[model samples]
Target: MNTIDEALGAVVAAGDLAGAVGLVWRGGAAQVAAVGWRDMEAGLPMHRDSLFRIASMSKPIVSAAAMTMLQERRFALEDPISRVAPEFLAMRVLRDPDGPLDDTTPADRQITFEDLLTHRAGLTQAGFHSGPIDAAHREALGPDLDSPLSPDAWISGLASLPLVGQPGASFTYGRSTDLLGLLLARMEGATLEEVLRHRVFEPLGMSDTGFSVPPDKRHRRAGLYGFDMTGKLKKIDAPPGGVALPERPGDMEFASGGAGLWSTADDYLAFARMFVDPSVKLLSPETLALMTTNRLTDPQRLGAEMFGMPTFGTGSGFGLGVSVVLDPATAQVMRGKGGVGTVGWPGAYGGWWQADPTNGSVAILLMHNMLELEQLTAGYGLGGYGAIMEFHALATA
Candidate 1:
């Protein structure tokens, strides 16, 4: 198989990938290409603006929005979250993995705004019905991350649940940013969608991102797809909530700051561009610097315990909401772009993006279907992306 041809073709050929869209934008120009069909059943062709379930990729965007609030002094990173969401002032830790529902204590340190952005807050989507906290959230907030809940209700719900580990201890990707969105709603006197739209999306010119897809624009909404372990692709087109509407509703479900948004390549790349040029920074350079710094203060020891493997970059470590590169020697895939000062995040549903000041460019991959992308690698976990980056490097070289 032609290595480059195979990597590009495999994305289209993968039986599990019913539809695929790939975008490459660097040096101020972009080219979008698609293969197969967006909907085999409906016979829709994938387009440049095809909306995707850019899941975890949503993290960096949402995280950046929170940092913007900090820039405006809407709040400080370390400020106790309890200032706006009072329920967290008396938070507790789960003493036993499985114990009494109400058994709890006051949090040693108040959950700070930084903790929420960094996923360092010990918040869980746990106990939706068993405890008073869950009951309060359900009753007051409607068990939705996207909808409105009293700040007190949001904090109490999170505080009442067991933390994955002590706050700021490890990188357990959970609902930390979602809490930040809820906090933004309380503090900014606006909803998560509103905060994002007003502050980030409008500025970046991201027109199609929101809580849900609208009906007229459903044509643009890429069909959501998931593959089983055996690599069988199935369409996951169900709206998260029981409510069904004619248009995609950004306010339909709990505005999940952690993982609840849809976006397109063009829209997302514009936001990624800001990272490359911080002169348009939504957050102060100092705040961005503070955020980009590796919070992996313990480096190897702490990292190993949290993640199955220590996921360090070229001297890189985990930061508030993105990955920060520290040393090139520590990089696993020896031959890609990001040198030392790159930071980025990937969405779970399907997408990867990185911004490297070192490269003076941001590379974003947006696709909604899953595949064993590592097959394109030389048996490397960087997946299909590794091969693409290497090929581009050689082409430019």
Candidate 2:
């Protein structure tokens, strides 16, 4: 059997990663292996407490918050969101960039609370679809979800655009969670950050998840890197946003439910723990059940070439915020038993976590820098495969 410590050590020592944090806890025992430096430039060591910008991992958290409100009767899943957000009332569909604008049709149905919760809503962000909407989204919503827009501005920008498809019609990954963030804000009369803190983070005792890295903790923060085709890490300037309920203070203007929460491997494991038991926080077992289900009504069949992912094949579906693997034989994953029941998501950067309730197992894999796309073979691609088998072996051992 390979010592987990050695497995993590080999990844960093080979320069395949700047740093990584891995944690597995179950059956009255716990193991954590964090190797490599948090900041490579200064040769700082990686700590269990080091923070990461867990892009997209933030969605399931926001969905959990909305689910709590759902169980509370704060809103009905079927209720049209236009009741809370009137901007969605006059929705339009895009034909093309220069296609007919005056000729349009209504959404298949009004966007509902459940649609937002399950990511079935007909809203989108820039770059998901190409054409006039792309130009329109950039002009309307500003830059990649990190743009400094007030919640009203963000909502209005999305509302003003045309739907790529109709509400609850299919699976398209974009802005439904941000809409949930907006819905929670309007319902609670608080900012998205405030709602998440009061509703999720503080209750879970995950003290370090936030939207921005502060000046003091900035040193402990991992470098954000962009990778080339060959998998080389190129550090990019750190992006900024308000911290979400930090035990420590930091500020950020953008609160993207799609992507933008900073977390430590430890903090995220605590967040994943909520799935095992939701004793203190926002979601009920039923709502959490709702979250993990295959929520997409019409998911497109994507080839591995589209995402540059070698492990995925032609038969996967999108669940709310995560990729739901439907067929392992077709999916081409390299390790362990992930069946249709396995539900998890990975970040665009290098953060990945998955919980298999079927197995009562959880795994957290964190990386600080981005290298070439092939690096995902190590970062998300290979890391996910390794973690699945490693976790299964750990639990069974």
Candidate 3:
């Protein structure tokens, strides 16, 4: 288990993982290991180029694209998002996050580009709330990964909902990035797919990264996998909570800027390199510095929670689009552990990565570790995370 192959191989052998592709880049070199099956029932092997639904991992790339727009003087961080999409101009806030939607207050201020990037726009996901708000979100937004509504319809639906908190007050992880994506598309007068393809993917050489897989490349895609209640590996189509779909509808016009994007281990490594290596040149040094700097206050960091646990704790902080490690020794594995400036945003589908500037290194693990919310709450399908911890620990060793 000293090497990444042996470490991940053990997880696969133990039935904790179906397959994964792990890569560690350091000292101007890379070490990669592809282990287990892409589809166990079909006996398909995992490869470095096997495509995966990167889920929330899509945030950083979309955030980077927004930053690029900033560099071009397209808009200022302080500008209200309503400037581009006026639907958000007259937004309301819930009196209590879990209270009735009708008990509300006017938003303190309009949401800004910074709010969307930092997830402080007061928007939230259904899972974070317990009352009418959750049901309201599910009815309006449909799924987090792929939505059936057109971009304009989706924006209107989201705007109709009440905010969960005051603008710029705290971190509420939800559809802020999805809104940001649509806003970007509106600004460019193009689809989000076009905007990202032209601005982010093309410039970065991320050919394989996009909202949908073309017919020619479908065979390289990984089949979704999850653990049964008994903790056995099982192939899954649509898991509970609507975090992902077995296959994105061919006609879906909505691109999830937050949780939607298919990519590979090497392709994401290329994107991760931009943060640690200045020579990659995707952003100006000053802009990159601003993007990676911690934006959350002490109270905000302490107050933010995901899955009923303090998200940043005392060891890490939230940046514009990624989590920054303040102290590796105390940072939780969910946020990852590394040097003070290490930054990464893990995806819900078991994808994780980190770029450590102190050591000039990057590590990535891509796998389809989907689990139902019930399974997650019952603690029935967490072996995937353990496998990720092992891969990351050994990859960065």
Candidate 4:
């Protein structure tokens, strides 16, 4: 059997990655491998504790926090979010998702909490659409991460745009969780960071996870890297389209619950443990069951598209915050492999984690596999996905 180090080292040597941290824990035993460099140019080695911009992986954490609130009877799943964020009360829906922004109709119904959780709120990211709607999203939501708008301003801006579909109609992946996080903050009368800290991080002992890296820990942060047009690894100070900034602004008020988070391998493992282990007790078993179970209808699953590919159907389903694996045989790479109820959500920056309840196991691979629009169009910067698949295969074996 190949060791984790040897398995991941091969990827680094192939120039597919600068470095990564891989971990697998099962039955009270753990295997951890830190391979390659945190910064190839700086000669810093990847460490188990090295911080990473976990991107959309932040979704699961925020969802869990929201679940905790649910358990407290703070709000019901069916409650309309308009009760708290009234900006959505009289929203419009785009007649055609890709058509002119002015061609719209009033929203058929109010968006509910569950709609946001399941990504059926009709909200969408700028990159998901083309033409007028896409431009509208970019103008409103500055970047996917570290937006300059305050939470209130951001919510108003998002509500001003027309939804891609009627609320609860179909799955349209977008800024739902980001809205959820801001709502959670509003409900708690605190910043999103404080709400998460009190609700999730502190309880899970995830000391290294947060929206920003403090000055003292700056050296431990991994430098972002991506592939150029030729498929060679290149350090990216700032990615195109402003998806992320090289340095997070100190006064930045936007805390993107969808894509903004920095965490390390062990800290995220602490978070993932709750899904597989009942003893962790982040939520009541009843609430946890609600969260991990598949929520999408068959049509919604089939209609959903992510990064221009069918998101579900093919042995997978989506729950509240995580993707549930229904069949390992035909599951897509993004869904990953595990038992019927295995749950995971991968980040855009090459971070992946899965918790298999049947096996009582967790597996994680964290890397900075940033890709630009042109690289994605040319399919030139996806070797890191291969690294993730290889790591999962080795970890399971």
Candidate 5:
């Protein structure tokens, strides 16, 4: 697995992965590679331009957009979110995480911009856990990936549910960023796509990045793949139609900040460059500094652990939307490449990327294969199977 083809082929031959596109940039040089098929059934070879449902990779981008809004004096991080989204004006907290729905208490205060940025807004996903709160989330907000409701309807549904914890309390990984997207749109009086395009995508020159793929670019869209019960690679679905994140007519109106965008290795590399290169100026120096730094309190770090997601490691903490590595020694537990102060996040669909501020390096691995959420929480996929550890480790070396 020393060469890119060999590395990707090993996984393809192993029956776990169908295709991969990876890029590593460091010290003003870049190495890009691709192997296997974007669609095995259709005999489509994977290319550097192949688009993948970047899942939570969308977080850092949306977070950057929010920072731009902050620079424009749209809203401060501490301002109550109710200023933009009135749905959150009066909110309730669950008395117990697993208790009945009616058992609740008044929130100590309204959720603020800072709370959503740090993921301490008491929001949580439904499918990852069990209990009444989880059920309520599923019934109200729909799945983590695709929801059938429009933006307004989705917020209406979310407003009806009780929060798992108090706002600005513990880190609960749910739809906080998605809610942020809606709020940003409301503030701009435009669609989420319009705001992100003007704020982040266009400036970064991410032409192929958006909530949905158009018809002409459909061929470049990687087919979603997953393992069958026998552990063999099975084609799941195609872009603009996958079950986890379908792109029907009205669905594009949501433009979820948490997990809605599709992008290529090169497109995301441009976005990653902003973190390490001051000249890129994708964000102001001070805002970028604050974003890459660890903003999590001690208790919030503990809550991140409870989620059991691979995006965070022992000595790492959540920043605005990305994970900040405070201690490289403890962060090595994830077996991915990075040093102290490295900032990045992984997508749900087997994508891993990191920008190492200390070393001036960026590594991105994009693939369409899906992994079980439990497997990801245990840190068994990206570095372990997709050779991301090897790819990124060699780049940094």
Candidate 6:
């Protein structure tokens, strides 16, 4: 059998990756592999504790915090979110997604907690879509990370925009989670960072995970990278103009739920493990089940497929904050091999993790290369994904 170490070593030698931290915990044992460099310029080796700007991976953690509140009866899933966020009480929908911003109609109903959790609130990413609605999103929300606006300002801006669809009508994957993060913070009368620390991070013993890396820990942080036009790995000089690295911590006040977290592979493994084992006790079995179960309908599921996620074709659907496999056979068509019940989501910065309740299995692969359009099309990012799949396949081989 090929060892995980050999596979990781091969990837590093090929220059497809600068460094990585891979962890696979199955049965009664946990195996970890670290390779290449966390800081190639300084010749620093990647360590198990190396920190990463885990964009989008922040969703599951924030969702877990919301679940903790849900268990306490703070809010019901069916409760109209307008009960707290009155800004969304009277909302508008775009008559044409690509039409003039003023061409709109009233929403069918108020957005609810379930609508936010399931990404059916008709919100879409301004960064991903191209239209007047997208333009409004950029103007209202600013960027995805490290927003210069306060939470109050951010929410006010977002509320002023028109939704892409009526509430609970379809899946729009842009900013629902980010809004959820703020809503969770508002529910607690604290910042998103404070709420997550109290509810999720502290209990899980994820000491190093947080919204930003302090000055002292900056050395342990991996530099973000992306493939150049020549297909060579290079440090990202300036992460696209409007987008921000919210996890890095700066003058920004908004803790974006959609993307804003810095963590190590081990820290995330601990988070993923909770889904497989109730002993972690982050949430009750029922709440955890709600998170991992498929929460999207057929059309909603099809909406995600349009984004070009390979796994979407294989019967995958969105859960609360992660992706769930509805058909194991179809899901196996992806580079990674997970069981029918596997649930986890990947970060835009070449990070992936999965938890399979069937075998008490958890696997995480962490890297810093940003997934660009050209790179994904050329299978450059899949080089790391293929390794993760190989690790899973090796476990059963």
Q: Where does candidate 6 stray beyond 4 Å?
A: 237-242, 245-251, 306-311, 332-337, 374-382, 395-397
Q: lDDT by residue for model 2 over 1-397, one digit each (tens)?
A: 3477676676666555677777775543557877777767777888888888777778878877787787888988789999999988878765542344455677767988877765557566664554566677777777555666778877888888788767776544677887788778888998788888998889888778867666777777876645445555445555322212323233445577667688887777777766554453446667666666655543333422233333234545555445555675564332123566555667656676765555555677777544344455545334434544554454335
Candidate 4 Cα outliers beyond 4 Å, as residue runs: none
Arranged by lDDT with the best first, the candidates are: 4, 3, 6, 5, 2, 1
lDDT of 2: 0.65
The lDDT of each candidate is 0.62, 0.65, 0.89, 0.89, 0.79, 0.79
User: What TM-score, over all chains together, does every model reach?
Assistant: 0.80, 0.82, 0.97, 0.98, 0.92, 0.93
Q: Tens digits of per-residue lDDT for model 1 on 1-397?
A: 3343345456556554555455555677765656556776688877778887776677777788887777778888779988887766766665542445466555677778777776667654433224444444445445443445445555565655655446666555556877787778778777778888988899888999987777788777767555444445656544333212224444353477666678887888788777667556566778778777777565432463222344553366767678776665564332123667677776644466677777666666566544333332223223334434543443223
Expressed as tens digits, the lDDT of each residue in 1-397 for candidate 4 is: 2488998999899998999999899987778999999999979899989999998899999999999999999999999999999999998998999998899999998999999999999999888887698888888878878688899999999999999999999988999999999999999999999999999999999999998899999899888899878999998886456876778888888898998899999999999999888779899999999998888888888778877778876788898888998888877656757888889989988999999998999999999998877887787766788888888888777
Cand. 5 TM to true fold: 0.92
Candidate 5 lDDT over residue span 118-232, tens digit each: 8889877776457787767767766555677778888888888888889987878888999999889888889888998999889989899988889899889888886555455
Clashes of each: 17, 7, 0, 0, 0, 1
Residue-by-residue lDDT tens digits, candidate 6, 267-351: 8988988978767988888888888788877867765533555336546887777788888777752323467768877777777
Question: Candidate 1: how many backbone clashes?
Answer: 17
Q: What is the C-alpha RMSD of each candidate to the true structure, in Å?
A: 5.4, 4.8, 1.3, 1.3, 2.8, 2.3
TM-score of 1: 0.80
lDDT of 3 by residue, 277-337 (tens): 8789889999999998999999999999987888889999988899999888888777868
Give candidate 2's TM-score: 0.82
Candidate 1 ranges beyond 4 A from true positions:
1-6, 96-105, 126-155, 228-230, 239-253, 278-281, 299-315, 332-337, 370-397
